[model samples]
Target: MKPHVVAAASLLLIALAATTAGAVTFNATDAASGTAGGQRFDQAVGLAYASQVLSNASTFIWSAFNQTSPADRKPVDAVTLVVADVGGAPAFASGDVITLSAPYVGNYSGDVKTEVTGVLYHEMAHVWQWDGQGQANGGLIEGIADFVRLKAGYAPGHWVKPGQGDRWDQGYDVTAWFLDYCDLLRPGFVAQLNAKMKDGYSDDFFAQILGKSVQQLWQDYKAKYE
Candidate 1:
């Protein structure tokens, strides 16, 4: 098996144990019950479906980070997905609760089901990912979430391809692109990097993991595709 797959299998026992006691449950609430988005969600994506997506996302992210034991991850008992009438951000994750925008749902075009699944995966990472106890870069945090989304095959058509972003930690899809390149250099790089961030973060993480500073790697990554 590949190194990350082997590591993932070894941690499966602990991950399974951590989940068996009903420690992880998901709830979906539509606060915009009468809106077009709510109706669309109900018809195309019901609460049960949303709950299943959230659960799957949790498992995927836990495995992604090699969070095999309780100590390796957060003790999240439950996650709630609320579809509400909101503006600005399409979705946001605060603790274990992910609030998705109803207006965005209503306004979105093409494959709402797939698009929503991607959003859930992105937000779900926040529920489990360590933030270096608030010392991690906010852009890195967001990028990690999108990295999970990218791995899940939900990368939208419009996202910049590999080596296209301006900077390594530019955030969102841009940073996700950079991190994907980093992961390619070392299988399980993302998982290892995330595990190290349980306490705090530093740019040195790139050098420690890949034997190169992030800036150097970014240049090399760009060169590879240019």
Candidate 2:
């Protein structure tokens, strides 16, 4: 058995002690355990911490989305994290599984734990969020995930400043900032928008929820920063 299995078992024990009902199970595994990057992850950000972050990020996402009850959220019962020797992106989520690149964690010069936490929060949002049944704008989906990360106070310094994207749905930090602006105009706008997306996405969602087209909102957001 790998070291992460022990950590995962410990977390399960803690969860069982805390709740007997409706608790989501979280697991973390290091597929690249013998690699240098994987060793760095085990030392700097152990499987225990990674598992805890997964659980924490899920709760934070639920609150961010105003998913007060199971009925208001996705039907995911478990989430898993895999640390491996991947490339390109730092991490990506497929269904309930999140893959974190061990190389990214090892090569990070600043704070790996904090950076990994932010990435986990963003990926966790993907695990719980609706994707408009594959009809939603890809950028919007990514933006919502980053929006959750932003709300959780985990946004990295490298992200674009508020109101700096070319378009509202350009994605990532850009769309997150735009969504933040909309939420300010009407509190819980992101949550409402997410609920609407349970079925499908529409640019008109902005007009329906905030009484203005998305383009106008983008212009207003840009004007504020300019």
lDDT of each: 0.85, 0.88
User: What lDDT does model 2 reach?
Assistant: 0.88
RMSD of 1: 11.6
Off by over 4 Å in 1: 1-22
What are the per-residue Cα lDDT tens digits for candidate 1 across 22-102? 368787777776898877877777777788889888888888998877667788888888888888898999988899988
Q: Clashing residue pairs, candidate 1?
A: none
The TM-score leader among the candidates is 2
**Candidate that would win on lDDT:** 2
TM-score of 2: 0.90
